[model samples]
Target: ERHRDMRRASSSLLGLAPRLLSGPRLCSRPLPLLAFARASQQRSGDAALALGEIRVADATGSLGVMTPKQALALAAERKLHLVEVAPNASPPVWKLLATLPVVEKRPEPPKIEEM
Candidate 1:
């Protein structure tokens, strides 16, 4: 009598067929890839000269003082971009170029002093 009651309860629970104790399950819809990117992009604006007084340099590397707007106008006149090369200077240094600068690889130091 006791064993038969336990069998009935076990069969009733198996009929539920829920995946709580089972393996993984897939979602109904996939998540967007650029959801966070689109949200944060509007906050930072452009990566180039976007704020404060900036020091600009032309192709010849001649430095000059100007507001950010003036620097941008000069960049637009030459169909180039105003990229910030050095941001830690007294007033940040910017350059006019068609595109971003390429980073060159540095050579390794000598190993003579090593043990």
Candidate 2:
């Protein structure tokens, strides 16, 4: 019985695949390619911050439709800027951090015995 039900469900989903894969319905509707490109650039910029480099990132929320400037001011205090952390969020969130001034710890010099 369970196997029969599984097959039925799978077939139902398969039938809908073509419609789901088809392009958008509106011929004149502007695609979000430009927005996606900008977001990609923003993500690359965020990578620099993750590497401890100084940078400013202006984040967008709600499908990149709304931007709140207050976030930028907060980031500036830390010498950083808001950057998108996850683009998949319904309203993406950003973080502020220094990108250029990553302080890498140096290894201590090895001690040598006097000859």
Poorly placed runs, candidate 2 (over 4 Å): 1-67, 100-115
lDDT of 2 at 9: 68
lDDT of 2 by residue, 1-115 (tens): 9955764566578674433333353563322333332443455332433332232344342223333454444555556645555555545555554653223468999999899
Give per-model TM-scores.
Answer: 0.45, 0.31
lDDT of 1 at 7: 44
Each prediction's RMSD to truth? 19.9, 16.3
lDDT of 1 by residue, 1-115 (tens): 9855764566477663323323243462223333222323221114544567878887888569888888777777888877766667778777786865444467888778766
Q: How many backbone collisions does model 2 have?
A: 5
Candidate 2 lDDT for residue 104: 44
Q: Residue 30 of candidate 2: its Cα lDDT?
A: 22
TM-score between candidate 2 and the true structure: 0.31
Highest TM-score model number: 1
